[model samples]
Target: MDAFYASVEQLDHPEWRGKPLVVGGNEARGVVAAASYEARKFGIHSAMSSALAAKKCPHLIFARPRFERYKEISLQIRDIFYEYTDLVEPLSLDEAFLDVTENKVGLKSAILIARQIRAKIKEKTGLNASAGVSYNKFLAKTASDLNKPNGQAVILPEEAEAFLEKLPIGKFFGIGKVTAEKMQKLGIHNGKDLKEYSLQFLTKKFGKSGLHYYNIVRGIHLSEVQPHRVRKSLSAENTFEKDLISLQEMEAHFYPIFEEVVRRIEKSGIKGRTVTVKIKFSDFSQQTRSKTLEQYPNADQLWEVGLELLRQEEIPKPVRLLGLGISNLNLTEEQVYFGEQLKIPFHISNGKG
Candidate 1:
């Protein structure tokens, strides 16, 4: 999906086509949920403050998110994926990983399957999708982003190492701004530089994550494409138009957000034992408070915990954003409680965050 939420808005509202458009709250503190290519040309992007985006592009059109429509289209795309392979790991509503090592249609060429999938998605949904075909997840994911809307990129196994070596460390998956800075300071600026370190050295430097970097830089990601990936948590958050200055004002905002979270939990039919409250100060500094309950909390119970967490925080600075989430999921009674802690990061909108 290309500029998914913004594109959807354009599709439904013909007048918005070819114009710079954004899908999110058009308020002072609101963050961008998604931006169209037209908007991107002006340096607008997701997670950027809406006020900043407007400043970047004065004529930017804003549309409120229609998640039900997005989810409907997503399901249609997923159905297309199922036509070829059952091994589809959905990273989000719009993106997924498919293993075509052995496909339903018995296609020997993964590239061909990828093209077919993209074609079918366009044909069925009247939308474009990009694809990447590779032997492993890392290469496949990286390749997909190399191309834009309605494009495909394939990285052959033989070309993988040379390709990766030339790529910057910042471009590699899992290497965020903070991690990239650390890598640059250590003279690890590219895949080649990353490969220069031994597994022991990487592990000692980065703890458990270093081992992951070691394998991926060598084009050695062995993780399987899991179709039945369990969802960990669901949450919703909002950026205030005006900074919330007091606990009472903050609590007013929490009520609607809590209702939204509860609505999603009920819809998903999943329950969680942990509740977390996230706050972003006006200065952009953020903190989260969480509590693991003895039992899975219902909507009311979760709200009670969230309120408690909010009361504990000292509001020295005004709050720019507030979020609440439930995690420590349980699928069934017979399923062992893995005690796996999952954090549901706040999305700026209903669809993608």
Candidate 2:
């Protein structure tokens, strides 16, 4: 899907077509959740402050995010993918990875599967989707973005090495601003330059991720596209409009986000033992503190534990962003602890001795 939220808004409200539409908060302290391509031409982008976007393009029409509608459409699109293959991994409401290598439709080519999937999506949902077909996950992901607004690109296995060699390091998976800057410092501006560094050296510098970087440069990724990627944790982090120095003021900001997380947990039927608090200073330095409970916690328990962790933080510097997360899940029937607790006698293994 292209400009998913905004596109949906435009489709439902025909008046917004071809005009710059933004889906986000229109208030004083709101951020852009998604921006239409027309808005993009004005240097407006998603995740940007709504205030800043307004400054960039005063005529930008802002609409509040409709997550429920997006989820409904996502389900419809997912069903279409299932018709072709069961190997569908959703990245978000609009983007997904489908492994059509051995499709249920008995399609010999992934490109044909992509085309059929796109056609079904447009017919069912009245939205356009772009697709990428490649031998590996990384290449396929890159190819998908090569064309947009109902486009398709394919990277054959024979062309993988040459294709990657000429690509910039910034275009590589997981290479964000921080990593790109680090690579540039080491004279690695592109894949060809990155190939100069040995796996041992990269691993020594970047720990476990260095090995992945080395393989990525050589077009040698073997990661599987798993559909059942269980979410270990759920969190919400926000960057403030103004830096917060006082703990009282910070807690006030966190109160709503805390409530939202609890609401999400209750709605999703998720429970976990760990509560983590993440803090970022004005200088861009970050720190995290967490507590593990002996038993899983509900909504009230989450607030009690989360607030305790927040109170323990001694603000070394003005805070820029704060996040709260729950993890260390135990969702099994035994772990749910509905039955009575039992004590069993232990028996030694005499046969082994």
TM-score versus the correct structure, for each prediction: 0.90, 0.85
Considering summed lDDT, which 10 consecutive residues are worst modelled in model 2? Answer: 336-345
Q: Write the per-residue lDDT of candidate 1 for residues 98-193, one digit (tens) a residue.
A: 999989999899989998998898888888899888999999999998998779999999999999998999999778989999999999999999
- What is the Å distance of residue 290 in model 2 from its true position? 2.0
Off-target runs (Cα >4 Å) in candidate 2 are 236-256, 278-287, 315-323, 332-353
RMSD of each: 4.8, 12.7
Off by over 4 Å in 1: 298-300, 333-353
